[model samples]
Target: MAMTQTQRYGVFAALALVMAATRIHLSLFHHDIWDASWGIFFLAGFWLRGSARWAFPLLMAEAVLIDYIVITNMGISFWSHYCVSAGYWFLIPAYGSLWMGGSWLAKRQRGLTLSTLGMAVAVLLVSEAACYVISNGSFYWLSSHVPTPKSFTAWFANLGDWYLPFLQTTALYAGLGAVLHVLTVQMARTSEHHGQMQN
Candidate 1:
């Protein structure tokens, strides 16, 4: 079912709110919930598939703004924050990987069948892996934060240490998103069926 303009707007707002609410790790509202920034981007991609020209940039801006506010709130300049570095810019492509993954899944999603679920999981794995490589690998190799004398062995170890945690967090949110997607699709189908019966 095609979404109305209002529905799209509503989804956009909800995603933005989720990002704001969870992105700030130190915020009182956060309660230490794992950051959903990565998953949010994927969800946005799935839901807002063709809106990348604008939606992606808007969400990206919001992420950066939230980071700025959080870092500056801690009495440090945003630029001086440990996470801010040359490698930070790589997030565009990293998040884009998730968005593309979501868009890819959206295009192929047929129903709540096992095949669909399998495809979703497969897409998530590949996309998240790509995202991790770009985000983590860049940070390890290019960011000034990492100690000097980087090696493939060291980076591989670093990847092993953090990859699962990142993937788990993303999967958790993606799972919720998937459930929501299924519910919406089911509801729409029911509504249409009812309409046809009435005719």
Candidate 2:
């Protein structure tokens, strides 16, 4: 469907809010639901377009806020949940890579062509790998009192166990969002056509 510019913006913004709330809820109360944080940021980059800059920053802030609330309420220290350090700030770039990948995909996603799908999958894989490495490496090297063996080898060995879950969750959410978007567009187009016919 040819969505009006305002309608498009509304849809994207609504999706972003929903994604943010879902991520926070899952992180706080239901860790078993799988995290959608990565996918949400990626979609913001792709769908928010001109607003991508502010959207990402806000999303990151929301994450920290929610984490703080969860930790305090649980009577736990945020630092105790994971080894944190100045290196933790690297999450900005880590998540940025995912956002950039999605933005790149958006440029090529005029349709659900095979080439586009292939490219999307490739971008998701690369983006997720980059995020995992940046985030994990930061903790392994910069964080104090890490439980992992003090070797790049040890970090690399356990990479898959940590990275795979993120990869799966991201792909699941992004793909689902894309499909729903397509359906929404189709429905809107159909409604417009029917209205015109009746006129």
Candidate 3:
């Protein structure tokens, strides 16, 4: 069955809240936790496939706003070490790849049958790999912070360093989100059925 309008709204709210809240949590404490920033975007693409046109750009802009506020409050200048080049805009394509992967997932998938679950895992792996590669690879090569050309192997090695964390974090959150979404929806269906039966 298709998601109801209300269910769609719930998902949108949950993802937006997770993105905002997770960033705050990470910013508050110094830790090696995986960054959920792009994970939110990745999931948003899959779960919010129909919402993509507005969702992607909105999330991108939201990220910029959050970064600005977070850095400013921390006494750091947004202009100083953040967004100092046109290369920063590379995030558009970097994140676009994730959105594309997710859109693909939505087109080819539905409920989590075993085969579908297998496909979902593959989608997550490939999507997050693309996410890390584009996001990190662009930063490494294009940013003024490291304005040096790297060999092909060296560039890939750098990608590897971040590949697992991005993949793992996104997979965890997206997986959990998918499961919870299914459960919540199932529970609602059951309640509705019981209500009709009681009547």
Candidate 4:
């Protein structure tokens, strides 16, 4: 029941590695403008359970790995990509902490009626704010270098076009994340119940 420090470290390390691998694979093959990938889920997981000291370093390493691959293979600028990628990690603590807190509140309330909604909203706002700031800022910087539509309004409009799609995708991911969390909690409860029955 009680995890040793080494066990915890190993678990965290394995999770981080799997997260990095999945993100890299998705970036290489299945990534699209509208598709949210495992990276988001990984951050959500870390936020839900991981310590900031552990999660931040893992996130930074993952970001650096992905940036190197993207720059080498896709010809994207590493600096710009790093800027945006770094933002995801920056936002993870706030977003994740809120979600974790919301879940705790829901537990105290003994239902998912009002508490769930509050938590969901909190998660959404944190996610959206992070996405908006990072994506928009990255796009703005990249736009200056590339041939984008000429005008702040047009630039934002284009950004909006991409933003809405990804937001939708993130919402879907959030829903999935919530379901996974619930399932995990249920399984733990069931296991505890079984252990009690045996005793």
lDDT digits (tens) for residues 71-147 of candidate 3: 78878877665544556677788777777777787788766567777877788778777766767767777667764
**Model 1 alpha-carbon miss at residue 100, Å:** 0.5
Question: What's every prediction's RMSD, in angstroms?
Answer: 1.6, 2.5, 2.5, 5.1
Q: Model 1, which residues run further than 4 Å from truth?
A: 25-31
Candidate 1, residue 33: the lDDT equals 91
Best by TM-score: 1
Q: Across residues 100-172, which tens digit of lDDT does each residue of candidate 4 receive?
A: 4433433343333566557565656565656555556554545445465557777666677776665666666
Candidate 1 vs candidate 4: the lDDT winner is 1
Best by lDDT: 1
- Model 2 poorest ten-residue lDDT run: 1-10
Which scores greater on TM-score, model 3 or model 4? 3
List TM-scores for all candidates, in order: 0.94, 0.85, 0.85, 0.64
Per-prediction backbone clash count:
0, 0, 0, 0
Worst 10 residues of 4 by lDDT: 34-43
Kindly provide the TM-score of model 4 when superposed on the true structure, using C-alpha atoms.
Answer: 0.64
Ranking by lDDT: 1, 2, 3, 4
Candidate 2 off by > 4 Å: 1-9, 195-199
Compared with the true structure, the alpha-carbon lDDT of candidate 3 equals: 0.74
